[model samples]
Target: MTTRARPAIAAMAYHQGAFVPFAEAGLPLTTQALQYGTGVFEGIRAHTCADGGKLVLFRVRDHYERFLRSCRLLRIETGHTVDELVEITCELLRRNGTTADTYLRPLGYKLALLPGTRPGVGLSGVSDALSITGFPMGAYTPPGGIRCTVSSWVRPRSAAIPIHAKVTGGYVNNALAADEARAAGYDDAILLDDRGRVCEASTANVFAARSGRLLTPPATADLLPGITRDTVLALAADLGIETAEHELDVSDLRCADEVFLTGTGIGITPVNEVSGHPIGAGEPGPIARSLAHHYARTIRGGGDVRHHHWLTSVRIDQG
Candidate 1:
């Protein structure tokens, strides 16, 4: 959690544009997404690939595909197809390669929405805005397991807002919980549903393993249907590990043999404790390490072949 602060961003790519300095990756203040969180986005990881540092994006196709789905759901007119988004993302990374751990974000926002006569931002226009930014980031480390505290803030009820969408505004919930956790002297926070069922970490999707079986919250449980979460589940299935998608409460975490969180930035990381209780002796369990290793291989190109559909190669010859 410590480093020499670097420039915020070196370069960025807006729709149909590339190699624009970060400063130029701006929009009018009246842009719909800027006025109201009306767009969706996806977080992708481009790891150092092959012997030549090719920077292959793990599951780039799937990420862009979901981004397309999100745009459709939001009624945004995305001018490009999924394949075009993939091409642009790869090109952006090739141009702005960073030395440290990095993350890629592509935001699809409503560019033309206007404020209604009531003085409130509304979905008056349907055109979308997409921008790609690649930056360096890392997470707080735990020597044995990440220690987390329950958050005082509850997740937004799905009936109020579609909690599943990766809208930038939805992260206000995460920000509030994370701030509470940090002030509570913890590395992260675990949020509960309106009904008090355990949801997920502030930003990362969560999973638990016990008695050789894995369990995680269902998509309907007010959690994002996370791409990395799905990939981890599939990897476990390939290894003959049984996984169950169900709603779990705090008691499950306190008694689980292991707990791990996954996301685009860090892949899979072990969480050894929750609310100050040790999870299976406070060390990363076999399931956690196994999934982590397999995930690393699959992302870095050495996992089971039957599941390679989730991966997208970066060897695209743009000539």
Candidate 2:
């Protein structure tokens, strides 16, 4: 896929109940979510179609479904249904007139304590707010591949937090893990569960290809069930590639033919090295390359008709 230059952030955003200038979309200092990290969010992408005629959002409904699920976990009410959120996202894209690859972040969070409510970090007494902002972004991962470190931070299990949900507060674990990896000169981090098994990467799902079959941890392994990871599994089935969901250890990845990470932001990126050792040939492997090619096309209305259903088209508002 051809990469585009990172464009300036859009000047508009969906704030509260209406679209507004980006500068006007700020939350107050007393916002409960800001103080307590009581928020949920989804990172969605919009791509210019192969013909460059218009922009299409990949799995927009699925993202919102997951977004709502996270909000429900946090007791945050978005006041918008899945379909309504989809339309609002399309309208936001149209208003921005974005013509390149873009990333959208929809955030639902606790606003403040409701009137007559006592001051506390309790979710029951807080008001809720939702906002979405978008900006241009291309493939953020290195095209060649990336090196990762087995992080010292252990991933929190569902017992400690809702590991399946994209809770804003839970990301502190991811941030610290990623920072440790970067400080060690690695591109990312692979986190292990309390049981000392591979759970996922800092912010993405981890996969290892062995004997032409793909293996990844089950959702019970204390990782967010990623939409992109689901897409890859479906696409692999279409390609007649076998897959299994099971626990994997560091030794498993070290011995596998290839290791890769999948997510909405980074797409599919190969892990060339881990903890100072090369994974396989220490480069992007054939399976990852093939899947990445197909993923790029599938997001842009390519492949089968069924795949096109995952895309939501929006015409640019040139006026």
Model 1 lDDT tens row, 1-319? 2122463554556543455877777787877777788888888876655443455577888888888877777777667888888888767765665534457888888776443434466655445667888786544354355777889899988887778878777888999998887777676888999888888898888898999899999988888878899998898988899999988888998889998888786578788778788888798999988898888778766677776666555552323
> Would you list the C-alpha lDDT of every candidate in the order shown?
0.76, 0.91
Residues 1-319, model 2: lDDT tens digits: 2233565779899999999989888889999988999999999999988767799899999999999999999999999999999999999998888778889999999998888899977899889999999998888888899999999999997899899999999999999999898888888999998779999999999999988989999977799989999999988888888999989999999998999999999999999999988999999999899889899899988766778889998888666
Worst 10 residues of 1 by lDDT: 1-10
lDDT computed for candidate 2: 0.91
Stretches of candidate 2 exceeding 4 Å from the true structure: 1-7
Total clashes for model 2: 0
- Model 2 is weakest, by summed lDDT over 10 consecutive residues, at 1-10
Please report how far candidate 2 places residue 245 from its true position, in Å: 0.5
